[model samples]
Structures are given as C-alpha cells and as structure tokens.
Target: MSAYTIRDATEADVPAIARVYEHAVLHGTATYELVPPPEAEMLTRFRAISGDGYPYIVAEDADGTLLGYAYGSAFRTRPAYRWSVEDSVYLEPSAQGRGIGLALLLRLVELCGELGFRQMIAVIGGGEHRPSIRIHEKAGFRHLGVMEASGFKFGRWIDTVLMQLPLGEGRDTLPDEATYPGTLFRG
Candidate 1:
C-alpha cells in the first residue's frame, strides 16, 4: 500500500487542483473542455462543492504533494434528481495505476452515502478507459450505458460512458420545500 493520506480539500489546494485539471484538459481526454477553466472559476466551483456539503477530497503524500482528488456533485438540477449525484476523480500523471484513484473513489462513495445520497454516477469519457471503468466496477458501479459520439473534443467525436452505483435505500419523495440543493450545480 502506498503511503498516502486522503482528506477534504482546503483553499490551499486550489492551485494544485487547477494544475491537475489543466494537465488533463490540455493533454488528456478525461475532460471535454478545450480550454482550461480560469482559476477564479475553478475556485468558485470548488467553493460551491465544499460549501454545500458535497465532498471535495484530495490525496496527498506525507510531504503534502497532491497525488489525486475526487468529489461528488449534483447530477442534475431537478428536485426529483436530488438523491442522484455525479462523481469525478482525477490523479496526477505520476500517481496513476498506484491504487490512489481507487482509494479516493471509495472514500467519495462512503462520504456520499453518509451525506444521504442514493445514487452516484460517473460520466466516463469513453468505454475503453479500463482503469476508470475498473475502479467504478470494483466499487460496485454498474454500466448504465454509453452515449456514443456525445461530445466533440480534439476535432473528433468522443463517446461517453455512464456508470452508476446506488449508495443508499429509502425515501420516495422530496420534502415540502423540494428546492434543489446547490450541491456542485449551477442553477
């Protein structure tokens, strides 16, 4: 087992997080965005994710270097979708294939279950991303389906696969207020 620690991300982690995300956007297909999000925007999104009780986690070494991060966010804005959430996980290139992704994902699931979410979804970039698929499958996520050619990136159409894991059981209706939570969602 690698010696790494997982914890809630702090404002101090934004730069490292942004660097990780920028690396993905510029060099990998993990995210479909063609341009790196501005630091302010990233900070706003990070703040929103943490402020509303949505988990934003980071994995770090004993010396405090970031290795990976994962988080659970609202899947959609409709009140009916309140119990469903979308999860994202990213690791530093140097940390890939070292079990860091699995650890972060497992912890995200545990935290989401504790926060009362009933379903978790991962919108994977492609069906052949075996590492990502394996992590979700090993964590009990089922293959929901794939949206073929749903995204255009890098001058080509990219397929997106959806994986799901039910986190909790109970509750058939929303509360009287029924207002959707601002949990990593912009609406």
Candidate 2:
C-alpha cells in the first residue's frame, strides 16, 4: 500500500493545489480550461467549495508532501440538484499512477455521502482520457454517456465523458430538507 494519508483540505493547501491544477490546465485534457487561474482565484474557489460544506481533500505522503487533491461541488445551482455533487480530482505530475487520485476520489465520494448528497457526478473533460474514466470506474462510477465535441481545447475538439455514482442510500429514500446539504434550503 502507498504510504500516504488523505484528509480534509485547508486554506493553507491552496497554493500547492493551485500549482497542481496549473499544470493540468497547461498540459492535460483532464480540464478544458485553457488558462491557469491565478493563485488568488484558486484561493477564492477553495473558499467557495469548502465553505459551502462540500468535501475538499488532499493526499500527502509520509514526508508531508501534497500529492494530490479532490473535492465535490454542487452539480448545479438549482434546488433540485442539491442532492448531487460534481467531483473533481487533480494530482501533481509525480503522483500520477500512484493510486493517489483514486484514493482522493473515493474519499471525496465518502465525504459527499456523509454530507447528505445522493449522487456523485464526474464530467471528465476528454472522452479519450481513459485514465480519468478508468479511475472513476474504479471508484464505481457508472458511465452515463459522452458529450461529443463539447469542448474545444488545444486547438481541437474534446469530448466530455459523463459518469455517475450513487452516494449513501441514493434515491432509495427521500432526503429530509432540514438535514440536506447547505446548497439546499433547510425546512
């Protein structure tokens, strides 16, 4: 097993998180973003996600170096979407293929379930991006479909792959409004 620990992310992890995401924005199809957001922008995003009671987590090795991070966010802004969350996971280049991303994703799923979310959605950026698709599959996400040529990046069209996983009891039971995630209004 890898000697790494997964834990909730903190504001202090923003800089490292930004760096990891910057690399992806520049070189990878995992995200359709063309320009890397500044560190301040990253910090603002972190505040929005974590402050909203969503799950944001990081993985660190024994020496305490951050290898990757993952988080869940509201699938959409509407009240009806409150029970679903969109999952995001990113790894520092060196951390690829080390089981860290899957670990972070599984932890994100677990945390989202704890937060009363019923569905976890992964909109992977590229249809050809098998690594990400495989990771989500390994995390038990079911393939929904691919949105062909939904994104233009690197001067070419990229397809988005959609996958989903049920969280907790899913739709087997209804959520009590008072205990639903903060994205929804309490009863």
Candidate 3:
C-alpha cells in the first residue's frame, strides 16, 4: 500500500494531471486521443468539468508529489443522463500497481454518490487492459459489454470495454429534484 492523500483538485494540480494524461495519450491504450492536449487545453477541460459541480480529485504523497487523479463527468450531454457519470482515472507510470488507482476510483465514486449521482460508468479504452478492468471490478463495477474494434490507435484497432456501478439508491427510488445533480445542469 502506498502512502498518499486524496483531495479535491485545484487549478494548481492541472499541470501535473496534464503530464500524467499526456503520458497515457502518447504511450498507452487507455485513451484514444492521438495527440496529447497541452496544459492550457487540459486546464480548460478541468474547469469545465469542475464547474459543472462534478468531483475532480488528486492523490498526492506527503511530500506533495502527485501520484494520480480521478474525476467524474456527465455521462452524456442529454438531460436524461444527468444522474449518470463517466469516470476517468490516470496515474503516473511509477505509481501503477501501487494501489493508487483503486484509491482514487473509490474516492471518486463516494464523492459522486454524495453529489446525487446514481450511476458511474468506466469506459475502459482497451478490452485487453486488465489492470483497469480489475481495478473497476475491485471497486464494484460490473462488466457491461464491449464495443469491438471501436477505436483505431497505435496503428491497430482496439476494443473498448464498458463497466458500470450503481450508486446511491441506483434506480430503486426516485431522485429528489432539490438535491439531484441535475440541478447543476440547469442554467
């Protein structure tokens, strides 16, 4: 087990987060983006997601080194999907397999559920990405399905794996409009 602390992300964390994501985009199949977005673009995205009242967090060591980050964002732009969120987690290469990713994910799920989200989805980029799939599974996500040959990256086609976890009351009960995360969607 690694020693780290998880906390809400601030603008100061964007640069480190961008570096982590850039490595993934450039060398891993976890994301389909062909080109890594620069820090400014990543900052823009961070503000958009956090501004929507979603949870974006970072994990850091006692020495303040960022190990990884995770966040929840609207699953889709449609109003009907307001209660569902898609989660993204990324870790520094050195931090992989150190239990940091799972920690970030569990925390993201807790924060999203607290904010009234009822469903969390993990869109694993490569069907063969066992570590991601295992992390999701460990955090209670169930295999939803897979999209075959849905992405072309690194000179080859890759399949995407879908996993889902129900949060809060899930679909067992109706959401209170006063506290629903959808309230953030309303202008």
Q: Which structure among the candidates has the greatest TM-score?
A: 3
What is candidate 1's lDDT per residue for 84-181, written digit by digit as tens?
Answer: 88999999999999999999999999988777787898999866678999999999999989999988887888889998988756355433333333
Off by over 4 Å in 1: 170-187
Whole-model Cα lDDT of every candidate shown, in order:
0.85, 0.91, 0.93
Instruction: Please write out the lDDT profile of model 3 over residues 66-177, one tens digit for every residue.
Output: 9999999989888888899999999999999999999999999999998899999999999989999999999999999999999999999999999999999999999877
lDDT of 2 by residue, 1-187 (tens): 4599999899999999999999999999998889999999999999988878888999998988889999998889888888899999999999999888898998889889888899999999989888899999999999999899999999999999999999999989998877887643444
Question: Which residue window of length 10 is worst by lDDT in model 2?
Answer: 178-187
In candidate 1, what residue range of length 10 has the lowest lDDT sum? 173-182
Question: Over all chains combined, what TM-score does candidate 3 have?
Answer: 0.97
Top model number, lDDT: 3
**Candidate 2 structure lDDT:** 0.91
lDDT of 3 at 124: 97
Error of 1 at 29 (Å): 1.7
What's model 1's TM-score? 0.90
Residue runs of model 2 more than 4 Å from their true location after superposition:
183-187
Estimate the TM-score of every prediction. Answer: 0.90, 0.96, 0.97
